[model samples]
Target: MHERHTAKARRRRGQRLYLLIVLVLAGGLAWLQISRIHSAAGVVSGQQIAAPKEGFLAPEIQFTGLDGQPHALSEFKGHPIILNFWATWCPPCRGEMPALEAVYKAYAADGLLIIGVNQMEDSGKVSRFQEQFHLTFPIFLDKQGQAGATYRARGLPSSFFIDQKGFIRKIVVGGMNEPLIQGQVSALLGKE
Candidate 1:
């Protein structure tokens, strides 16, 4: 009888251990999913800034072009705009330039304007980078980084998608490949 009782107790302990393990695993998985969701929702500077939702007017950006011409975001009011913030020294920004150039060429005839806002870089470096990449899109020099600050670009290779009505439709905060750039451009042009 004692042996039988000991066997039953052992079974109960084993079942309890199994339940504990399952609970721990489930709790861990839940935490991981929550973290992912939070990260995707935008956490910048240790604070959460709500993404500029669709239909919100984009902040004004004024800068001098590499061609010695003044430019303003409002000037591109009638067309879709891809406002990209980048620096010549940023690898990811360099990596994404080709894709930007391709998308610009593919859609420029359709009134797609791509503006590369160089973050506090000298005109010489910007010009060299543009030449090396064979980038034909307009390059704007953000000498004071005002445009970058206004756009709240926390990282290199941030892009804002603006529609014809001058409303910001989407914001991409990292490097983009051809497919991603094309997808965003298509959406901005209302093809998606």
Candidate 2:
């Protein structure tokens, strides 16, 4: 009986240890993405936009808007832009949408552009998601994953804050709360 009990306890411990390890690894990976520990992470192959850091020129992207019209990143150069890469299936992405929309509405008149780049999802599903969130910002389709690949958005809810000069000011890899979004936008708009 003692040996049997001991064997069961060991199995349980092993399982717990495995789970703990997984959680630690996941947290570490998230931290790396958020903190930008990997400096060379966004290397483009054969003309792909290189992974950008703070102060790097925002990538020149070619994307299709939901309106079926083509848009270029350079066209929004004079405005402060929040270029977000997300997917409908990502929980963090879904969680951040409301905050993003709120900030976009609050600063739209101030030339704040929030472009939602849906990663590899169908246009219909993305449109439905936009409607579900009551979002008014323009959503672009990264159908071939070219944009995300260039941006090297290691996490699902990544956002690149671009200043008026078209340089990336910040890169956040996790969900952002409303207040944080507000503060960031305020600063970008020179209000803070």
Candidate 3:
């Protein structure tokens, strides 16, 4: 009788251990499924509002600059603004900064405002990157990525061209060559 009781207790313990393992595996699978679902949803939602129209007045959003001053998109009306959403960690974003800086230098006097909205980066890194690149334009910090969400930035190096009327005229995503970007900028500037 004593031996039978001991065997029964051991079997119950083993059963509990097995059940716990199964529960852990189930939880991990659920997490993976949820993540996949979010990723898919993001992709689909991105396709919906990817283009900018001539008469489209942009949504108002405020973000902190590298200097800690508040910068609002609405304040730069009557000029074409290139709002570039980028991060220090993104290689594509890094690749396009030089081209963007050059465009800014060339057309800044012609009323081109290049607003670099750095996403998910520490200020120190961004400051150092700005110094490294000799980037003269104001760098806005979107630490919480709220500005990215507001702009519907789906990937790194997403950019929007806001025209003189404060309307979004074009949207660019990923790493595009200088000519393409410049063309878009010029088209929005109405220089072409």
For each candidate in turn, the TM-score is 0.71, 0.72, 0.70
Best by lDDT: 2
Error of 3 at 60 (Å): 0.9
Off by over 4 Å in 3: 1-55
Q: Supply every candidate's count of residue pairs whose N, Cα or C atoms clash at under 3 angstroms.
A: 0, 1, 0
Cα lDDT tens digits, model 2, 70-179, are 88888788999999999999999999999999888888999999999999988899999999999999899998888888898878889998889776778899999899
**Please, what are the lDDT tens digits per residue for candidate 1 over residues 113-178?**
999999998899999998999999999999999888888888898999887867777788889999
lDDT of 3 by residue, 16-98 (tens): 99999999999999998877755564354343232343345666778887878877877787888989999998999999889
In candidate 1 the C-alpha lDDT for residue 5 amounts to 100
Runs in model 2 with CA error above 4 Å?
A: 1-51
Query: How many collisions between residues are there in candidate 1?
Result: 0
| Candidate RMSDs in order | 7.4, 13.7, 13.9
- Candidate 1 colliding pairs: none
Give the local distance difference test score of model 1. 0.85
